[model samples]
Target: MLGTIIVGVILVIIVALIVRSMVHDKKNGKSFTCGGDCGKCKGHCH
Candidate 1:
């Protein structure tokens, strides 16, 4: 039914976002946390 299709599409989108975020975090050497404070960590990171 239409409802089932909608649910399936949403699930696919969520999975894609998770995969994208993981790759982005790995490339930036950052964990899943985005506290954004950066604080002292910024100096060594940049």
Candidate 2:
């Protein structure tokens, strides 16, 4: 139906935006897996 198509399109757009943001962060040297606590990170971010 029209509603289903609209929902699917919206979901795809949302996923695309998320991926774009992740890529931007990666390009800026951001770590998605790092907890931000270097002491506890145990050199994982290194």
Candidate 3:
């Protein structure tokens, strides 16, 4: 039971960190996609 609680807490922390980072990126006008300047891509996975 203690182990399960610890795992859940860790998972929550990880998710929180990811959410925070995404919010930060959005505020900075950043994209979490390919992270490149290929130009032709234009935000598409193609």
Model 2 alpha-carbon miss at residue 38, Å: 3.8
lDDT ranking, best first: 2, 3, 1
Clashing pairs in 3: none
Better of 1 and 2 by lDDT: 2
The TM-score values for the models, in the order shown, are: 0.61, 0.75, 0.72
Clashes of 3: 0
* C-alpha local distance difference test of each model: 0.73, 0.79, 0.76
In order, how many clashes per candidate? 0, 0, 0
Q: Rank the candidates by TM-score, best first.
A: 2, 3, 1
lDDT (10s digit) by residue, model 2, range 7-46: 9999999999999988887787766676344567676765
Off by over 4 Å in 3: 36-46
Query: How much lDDT does candidate 2 score?
Result: 0.79
